[model samples]
Target: MGASDTAVAMSTKDSSEASLGATAAGPTPAAGTAALAIAQARVSQTDLTGLTLSGRYLVTRKVGQGGMGAVYEATHTLIGKRVAVKVLLEKYAQREAIVKRLKQEAQLASSIGNEHIIDITDFGNTDDGRTFVVMEFLEGESLAECLARETKLAEQRILRVGAQVASALAAAHAKGVVHRDIKPENVFLLKRKDQDFVKVVDFGISKSLRQSSEEEEAVRLTQTGMVLGTPLYMSPEQARGDEDLDHRVDVYALGIIMYEAASGRVPFSGANYLSVISQVLNEEPKPLRDIRPELSEEFEAIVAKAIAKNRNDRYASATEMLDDLNAVIEDPTHSTERAKITGPRRLLPKAPKIPRIAWAIGGAGIAVAAVTIIVALLMGSKAKKQLKNANANPPAARADAGVATVAPPDAGEMVPAVETIKLTIVTDPPGADIFREEELVGKSPQTVEFVKNNKEVNVTAQLPGMEGTTSINPLERKDGAEVKIRLKKLKGPPKVIIKKTGETGPQKQQGGTTSHTGGELGTNPFAGSGTVH
Candidate 1:
């Protein structure tokens, strides 16, 4: 019999003896003895120190405890290898649904032979009906701890970490497993062989997408209308409790994680869980560029596509997203066309109106000039005819109309005036250096007049720590155009550099023991336990 079974038998025997002693005494004494027996049984169920499991694992001490189960640091008796043993709490061991889910977590994780995923070695129940799973012990802190210490991650580090995670997710998705609960707390950073390696843990809420005739009924742990993911990173479809979910939900969650890593904040947040879910369902995240402008446009585009509201719009698979990330890592300048955002409407300055008097005066002047030119032409023609006739008949002189003839000035001298328009450039945090066509123009918030041209103009804005450049197309109206550039502050060097610990071998150490009660499941069903068995 298993350890749990033996403990149950012992508890039964103790309760029987207490009942007999109470029967020999009064009814009040019998009730008191029965209460004491129940308390003792509860304590015995949790006290598994120095106990042996399956004749292989020897429990030394408890490492972690949570709502679902408690994790213990154990050693294999024969091999003397350290391992982590996760036992389902006795209170929840009786729940068929919870037990099935825990078993599924062990079975599914063990099947995937991925280096980035936690490895499960064995899983079974104790003699006393307490289920447990044994996995390879790891010495490292979770990504959650790292994020808490370092508010944000470096760009290169984020990409490297994201790529590794995507690769793991790709493996899982290929095998028909969708990790429904993916968060920082579930990602572990282990120091292995002088290198930082990522290990994705906690597949307790993961769903197997493969449909088999025998497992159809067994895969119904998550019923319709039941939500099962973290609200902060939950996708819209998941938040809505959609029954038909796939690997894209994991993609969305990864995008959220990446967003936080880059900006030190999640796109959507609220005072409560419901409010956060509501925001995820109805609100659109603020553009990433607004938070970190120095990030390449291509990188932002990749993230935007991953977190698209519609699953169809997101990357079809994790591999596709990984490819884009690889491209960005190779060349930061690479960019892809994305949907444009028409920002909030601004109240533009009203255009100055041309007075009617000016128009009337201009019109009168044009008419007078036209008349003078016409009269001059008539006189010139008359003089030309007279000269022609005189030249023909040199001997005959006409003295009735004596007039000196003059030729009109050269037509080339009358040139049309060039038209010029005003171009204005403004920066978000004003006083940035402005450049036009490689020529250094004055500082921003300045206006200059240039001859109107049909070609597009390229303008660049630069400051000590912020910079932005854009092309302004030719304006169709004579009022010209005003261009506003929003400059992004450049990201400084990383505050912390995560290095692999030099300790190559694992130390024989154990965690503190803490008794956990109740059967309530939090956001992370298996919070303390790395993986549920």
Candidate 2:
């Protein structure tokens, strides 16, 4: 339960995306095998056949039963939506004891509006006095199930799951809740028709600071001696039964889960649950990169931080952890710098012996050296030209006009030829991005210098998770008529709501047509291929 064994299967699973309501039947362990022992032992005698609730949610069948409760797949009468409802067995619901706690679980989980966290819409008791919690019907497999099919995922996919779970944890943590049980089984990876969604489940053992510590509430509903969480994912404090554990426990668990997802192995394992707990407390698991050397150092670092033994060493909140994961995904190189240089900086050659302006200011000694270097370059050019001139003419009658003359060099030469048209990248919160002619460029605050004069200049700036602004105009300035652009960050995609005069839309575009794609706004239609200064 704490450390997953199914992760070994993730690597070999089919790559094609599954569809909504799709269920892949994985191989099941023999009933008496060690792997299936705990699951089999927990099977309940409670019969849910023909049980109906609210005259609508029809109990289909028992999906699984565990130490906490029994889960069932049911159908909603009106919407015909399939949902899973967890019901407390008769033993736990003897006196409406578990009913109140399950209600609290629903309330606490409902407060968390994050999509990654499971949605609990209704909670009630049946005519037979059994308490039940109705949650969204998940069509996808649990992380454990997926891991069982394939232990390790590609780096990109792992990052996607990590980012999503982090967001779920963040939402839960912000509401003063801690999901004491954070493991692969509790993290469901649901696939819609076109995309996958992450939903965290099983908050039955969750800790909420908002709940009162009265005598009734002080006594936990779970039976004593029944270890609440999977041992491998439990933090040291949690394993020690420390009542003061906070969100840090979840941090440690998230790290363990991510580590396993990447390497298909847990950081720590033992012959039995007790030994595993002992090792978790006394030993540090080997680094993930040790198992998969190809793993990014930055990713390893993030896992290390999340699994830090000391709570203080872990990220302060789930959002912080999520941000780190997103950063790692967005820029894999951020984790480490290689001996080789990359990006635009690599274009330059070895450094010059003296700076460019050295000839102007250096003393006579260095000046002579610089002059010699320049003269050598000139001599080489002269030789080439002389060869051409000799070929063109038999002998140069000492020419009165030695060389062709051209107009003075353009001012554009003094500046970088890559001068991008100046356009302010306005954001709701200002940010930087490169854009041209209402199209995305690669840099911000850029200048297009190398281009010839009178060329059309389209400049734009783009910021991630925000709207981008672009301007298209000819860059035929005489001296310096500054093109002042004011870009505003749009709250949503650029919308075209024709307001009489002062009605505001998500985008405040001064000019150009508007359209939306993927929750983003774009002004101006796509332009034909042409160079923009």
Q: Rate the local accuracy (lDDT) of all candidates.
A: 0.67, 0.60
Per residue, candidate 2 scores C-alpha lDDT tens digits across 1-533 of: 11121231221132122211133544323322433433432232265544567677877887888865888999887889888898887777875545666776798799989999899999887655678899987877899989989989887678778889989999999998888899999999987655457899877678786666772354354555645677879888887777677898998899999989998988878899889888777566665665888976567667766786656546777887777677656444455632221101111222223213222232443554445446544676475355335334534333453422222224343233233221212222233544444333333223222132355555544455444433444444311112223345567765231333543322222222122211111111101112222
Which candidate gets the maximum lDDT versus the true structure?
A: 1
> What shift in Å separates residue 41 of candidate 2 from its native position after superposition?
24
Count clashing residue pairs in model 1. Answer: 7
What is the C-alpha RMSD, rounded to one decimal, of candidate 1?
A: 23.8
Report the Cα lDDT for candidate 2.
0.60
Worst 10 residues of 2 by lDDT: 517-526
